[model samples]
Target: MKKLIACVLTLVLAVSAVGAMAEGLTFSWWGGDARHEATQAAVAAFTEATGVTVENTYSAWSGWEDKMSQYFASDSAFDVNQVNWNWLFSFVDGEGKSKMYDLNQVADIIDLTQFADAALAQCTVNGELLAIPVSMTGRIFYWNETTWQKAGLETPKTLAELMAAGQIFAEKLGDEYYPLALGTYDKMILMVHYLECKYGTDWVTDNKLNYTVEQIAEGVQFIQDLEDAHVIPSAETLIGDGADSLDKNPKWMDGVYAGIWEWDSSASKFGAALSDGQNFVVGEYFTDIGEFQGGFTKVSLALCIANSAADKQTAAQLIEFLLNSDEGARLMNSQRGIPLSAKANALCQTEGLLDPMVAEANGKVIAWCKNGLDPQFEAAALKNSDGVYADAFDGLSYGDYDVEEAAEVLVEGINEVLGA
Candidate 1:
């Protein structure tokens, strides 16, 4: 665990930090039903405690990224936002000016002592404290143990075994069954992970892509190899399934889609979606993916005050209350993963509020991933619903581009974002 070098208090504010506020603020986020419920409850409690009226706008994560992008561009963003780490680069300007407010302005109101300097550092841009991180996360494998048992195989511990199991599943369980499912952004993440393991390098370094066309072509081939092996469904099949996300897919819930490559923070939601008696177990990272071990962990989500907020202090108070207060901490539990705030984390520990599956997956992810993620790797232009990742993988899967051609398109599009 990273130690928090808590920001020291410089001023004793005269105003009551938790006092009633007259301004009505807007807050927005994206999550599953569980998170929405937990957060709304917390918001209600916050409102009761402090006379602040907060209007909430939240939705599923699917197209929420693009909608948030539009909100920022239109200068109509909510006063408080549940921001992803990459938004630091996505919403910032050419001169490094941030779209988020400098939290330092409300330092007297929010107890900055709850946040680690390291976590706070990732949310900073051009010396401005832009956002407060909620949790750290990395993608890890999760499998439906019951489905694997029915296939007469154990959860795969090696990449070769995983590909081989696809054949076994098909022969035994028929055409609709798959060992794993991945969407466009998931494929993008997996390809980079494969390359990083082979080359022993980060995906992006100093605003430039680290791999050449040929090297990336090899990664693209690996994705094609998975489809050929039936280890995962094609993009066309995933589209045909008509589910917005894997967790919401009937096939996944019923165990025909047996595994996922997903963020550790999401383990609970996915596990909860499975049919009764289906065992959802965390899987070991495949050691034979390449010559070296590789993956990256980053801030899972964060709270930010928009620069356009009508009342900055009130917005900061909502953040402070949600992350640092005992009432808010208990209500949130591990809905957002292990809290990055020391006070919240300690409270969860003492109250026994941690979700066992989420904690276990989180522990494995942080311990295994050996690289730092470049924020731009997940910038909206690259990871959004209809963005570069979707285009590259969709075109490849739909037969519009061969592996090499897809590599060219992927590289060109990434370069455009990096140069912008």
Candidate 2:
């Protein structure tokens, strides 16, 4: 009987151990193959160190927003997932505020001070840290040094100089090479960049939503002129698809186009190409008017938090791990902007994975402006602005519309969007 009792006692201890090891966790994110591999490795490491069962949920960008909305609305959802920065305002601003976890509760689990001021500020609304910033982000000019030198033009610092360089590039490269490679389908993204050059601080401060009609007209005219001047490549000839231009042509690899405006991660493309004997460099932001002010900036990427969990403690642990761990920083590397955390930055340098330009741009990001505007307003302006480019490009190639009429039409469209 004693022998039977001993066996049963041993079995009880085994079952208890299994239960302890089964502590559940789930985290989701969107990215390509490399991000997936690195994130999985990080999770695996976390699990091995803590004996937790981590459920990884990840996908591409398409339909990611819809998936997140549904998950956030339902009870059966990931404990933590990646989100777009804009979504922070979407959720916390008016209606969706109540459905988030208080960062203070999990403060012991994660260190918030590690993140940069701008990134951290974006996550804070009404003095609450809604999400942790994993990376720094902004728009930047990426140029192919090889292509520019071949054209015999230095990198342009001002907008006027950029136009001159573009003409020279077009003259030399002829039809095969574009002075500036533009992702045509995504031209809407460029509208803000051009607007920044035209209006300066007024673009963000004076006319975030309420710009005078004349100002809008001026901004629209500026873009049309750039298109008319042949600075931007013809859409039909160069861009196959707007959404995936970076992956498809990878301007740095082609060695034909001079430069393109893109996000922080763009530098990595050049850096990656260099590993294979291709060389490139990141250029400073260029403006047409007075000293070039900083160009368009994105408010932030998504901040993630959990709604339901069997054990909030475990979920918090995982969140802290990804946000503050050196292993997590290396796993993501520069794939996500620069690390949002200063500690994360130091960790990356220690690992020899830091990108210098990205580090610099992260310092200049516009902060506390994540809210107080609507993207739909920007979208409307873009639709109207498109006409300016469409008319200019079509007229130049075919010689139909005169310069004055083309400029007038562009100005009119901007005025309409601005409600002037």
Highest lDDT: give the candidate number.
1
Per-residue lDDT for 1-420 in model 2, tens only? 999999999999999999887768878888666567877887888888778889898976556766876776665557776766655544442455634566667878888777667656766766777677776455566667777777887777777877777667768876566556655323434554555544444343333343454554555455556666777765555634343435445453566666666666434544454324445666666545534353545544544566565676787777677657777777766666776667767888787876676655555434311223332333323333244555543554345655456446545654555555
Q: Where is model 1 more than 4 Å wrong at Cα?
A: 1-22, 93-96
Residue 146 in candidate 1, Cα distance off native in Å: 0.9
What are the per-residue Cα lDDT tens digits for candidate 1 across 1-420?
A: 123322222122323343334458899998888899999999999999998888999988877877888888677899999998888767865666788899988989888888889888988888888889999999999999999999999999999999999999999999889999999999999998888888889988888888999999999999999999999999989999999789989999999999999999977889999989999999888889788778888999999999899889899999999999999999988899899989999999998999988888999988888878888887767786778888889999999999999999899999998893
Candidate 2 residues lying further than 4 Å off, grouped into runs, are 1-23, 92-95, 116-118, 126-128, 184-190, 202-210, 238-243, 250-253, 266-276, 296-299, 360-420
Clash pairs, candidate 2, are 83-302, 84-301, 84-302, 85-300, 85-301, 85-302, 115-341, 136-338
Worst 10 residues of 1 by lDDT: 5-14
Give lDDT: candidate 1, residue 367. 87
**Candidate 1 CA-lDDT value:** 0.89
